[model samples]
Target: MGGNHAATGAAAWIAVTASTPIAFGWYPVSDASVFTGALVCAGAALLPDADHHSGTIANSLRPVSNVVVKGIEAVSGGHRKGTHSILGIAVFTAIAWALSLLSIDTGDALFGAILIGPGIMCVLLVAFALKALKITRDTKLLPWTMSVTLAVLIAIFAPEEWYWMPFSVALGCTVHIVGDLITTNGVPLLWPLKFRSPYWMRNKRGLELDWMWRAGGNLSLPILGDAGSVREWIFLIPVSLYAVTGIVWALLDQMGYDTMAIWYQIVAALPF
Candidate 1:
């Protein structure tokens, strides 16, 4: 149904992570938590797309996200300028986090520690970011809400493995943040602190064309600039290989886990 690239990537990442517990002996094939964890983690990774009114989950909650996005946009300006600010992150996370508390057995972790105990510190951090960016609202709250909801659902059901579920979900959100950051500039992940996380994607080669097309081939994204110098090419080539390597690794890991799941299923079904 026209999946988002970043969402698909997040799901694959969830699979990669969920499989690790099995690989490490923290859980078994029969564990409901493991299965639930895999499913929920995938959804959480894809949660940020709620910003798109046309998005699957977002479309379902048009009225709410529309209002939220509108309010945020009025307050913050537009994409990357406000909703990507710190206030946005906290407000987005708070609702999900509170809901999570009701459903899951939250533990202590970095995200949790920051979320709990005088946690106004973290919220203020996010708030300060929003204030600094002059960001007050967004046109895209649906995707963020949906993504965070999925994370909370996962947290409620996922079993404790390598780390806490909230932390894992928080980390998952970071992937979404970082994914977008690669495409745009002046992205302040944490606002109000005088720190700017500006990682841009404007190279003329490879996926630059595909990405550029999404922005309407606008002036901001170029077609073929210089392909950069040999040194830059060296950096670009290996970094580009990340896509290939990540795919292969995920595929092999999936096959291995599936094989294990099947074997265990057969054993459970054995007449002996």
Candidate 2:
């Protein structure tokens, strides 16, 4: 589910950035920004699940992650409750926006030399992404190192505008909610306000259903049955591929490679 969430997050970012009719071209950022935002979004996709003590993100680190998870669990009113809500998304976006303003360059040598603001944010995000994607499994060291390296590279070469941070966070978190909404256990999008199950979904005999409704219950489509179901895989695989292809295409386009021209040449050479 973590991997699936990450994939959806990346795919959503790509889709939103794409200049297509379906996307509406909301974010007209540079190719580099799109690529960077996609990675950040991928990691943030798993952030809402931090309320689950046993989740991959909660267990990714040691005492720190455990402590954070406990805190989130306590505040969010258990797993899949508050952290999966609209309020949670707002909070996350606000925090990201605040951090985006913390960058320092020039005058302050310490801040200028070190990747303080968005750098740290990017490091953590990319690290979590690597962990969630299983690219740095069995050890946290590799993810940390890779994250730091990418952060450093971004600080050196990428543009300084951190305006996209909040958007990426919001998109990632929202996509996460959408992903969970399709599972057997749905997320509470509008928390702090309980919702009764629609008459058709009500189960009079089950105390669990009653409790869920009372605790600002879940909102689900349940098309995937459960997390990591075959349906989820079937849906996510193509999305992940689309994200990868978009990233590659963006990079190539940035390098001034006209893919359309190559495609036309290939088509012309092909047999009719």
Candidate 3:
């Protein structure tokens, strides 16, 4: 899946999850916490594509991304290898869970450092030094790094409820894998037990399945197609409607509105 589509899918998931009873067990207590969890999920959604050197995440992270991508590619042998597989999601989930187990107090201290004078200055100085040295050809890298750095700092300092952090990250990763399943070259979902997209969805010359993939693939354009495309709408409309309904229902419930009663009233007013 394109980076933008992955992001949109993740956002839609977050919105729907936030507004539904399904996520009640994992829900955070505060709005700020909810937003933090959503952001983490969104970032994690882009992590699998870290192996694609030209990918948005990689372009955003620069020299660090170059190193990270190269390392992963070396071990995995190419794009859509380990990171796009079931094994990757499990490993990442485990890592997130382990990180969650760390003393919250320690995270708080590091968070403080990231926000304070010396910590902020240290980051700025390093960025400046890197820019002056021309160590990276991508000028956007500095700003992207700074933005990501600040986001991480906020996540650490402000801190959502512990348990949901890992869950949100893992959910994001899972969403990414699912999104890639619809692409021209479907993801290696099962990895060692490789299989292509089901027969119904397979590409075959002159067949409907082939045409579907071609259209969907074109609509899956990462950033641009996300703006507004019929193909995108085909996927987005139903999901967006579902998510909006959930969000509205959740909001009304929180506000003490009798949503069911309002729905009944609207239905009664409708002409037969």
Candidate 4:
């Protein structure tokens, strides 16, 4: 797992790239727009891990995620299988595109029902049957229950473009796959064929290009090991810097500042 931090970093990088003048030459972006895009990208980064029952995505979605995780595991023979493959990317992207085409009203209604119905029922059932079901002591369900309810409420009531939601999710999933490529157990980039990154990136000397191919595989940092570890830092730090710089430049450009001249001024002001 790239963990939340790495996943977020990847998403942030994507968001920053998308916010660039070059990337959005045909489109306009405001602060709100950039923020929304960033949020979507970050959320999408976690989509690939939907198959992992204990993962953040699964946990957030709870009961529904339970079913989804199990189903994916059963069909794919476990994690890092179908969902991590190129075919999986295509499938997810298609789903996102399709979802983007959904009528706002229809989508809101359906999502509202899914979120509210289960939550209300769960609340009523728990309240009435707490003692009867011997569930009085366990309060763990509350968090997920509340989360579902709140998420749904936000999804339905919040003002948003709506169409980009699915695309953001798809983008996140794609980022997850790319993030996994750094792991020791590289993703099945081409599933069914089961071609892992190591095999393809191996040199003629019969050695895996560990540095370039399995970068995350070598992480040994403490606490955030394997996720925001040293290896991740190597890629994340530079990308983050670039993203921040881009955001600043964009904002300055929008404000009518000569961003390049500003950069030169900052450099000139340095003690060195």
Best by lDDT: 2
Per-residue CA lDDT of candidate 3, range 1-272, in tens?
Answer: 34344444335444645634434534434443344444445556666665676655555446665776778666764677778888888876786676555443444444532323222322332332233224433676554576457545654555444446556657767877766655445566556555433555554545545322333222122321323345655776565454345545656666678867887887899998
Q: Estimate each model's TM-score.
A: 0.41, 0.85, 0.59, 0.57
Comparing 2 and 3 by lDDT, which wins?
A: 2
| Higher-scoring candidate on TM-score, 2 or 3 | 2
- Clashing pairs in model 4? 44-172, 45-172
In terms of TM-score, the best-performing candidate is: 2
Tell me the tens digit of each residue's lDDT in model 1 across 1-272.
Answer: 11222333334344444433223333223333343333333334434443433443333234554565455555655444444444545655565566434422245552332223112212222222222122323334533454444344433343233233454345444544544444423235544334321233445455343333333222112222222334434434443344334344345554565555655787799999
RMSD of each: 13.2, 4.0, 8.9, 9.8
lDDT of each: 0.38, 0.77, 0.53, 0.50
lDDT of 3 at 132: 25
Model 3 compared with the native: what TM-score? 0.59
Output the worst ten-in-a-row residue range by lDDT, candidate 1: 117-126
In model 4, what lDDT does residue 51 have?
66
RMSD score of candidate 4 (Å): 9.8
Residue-pair clashes, model 4: 2
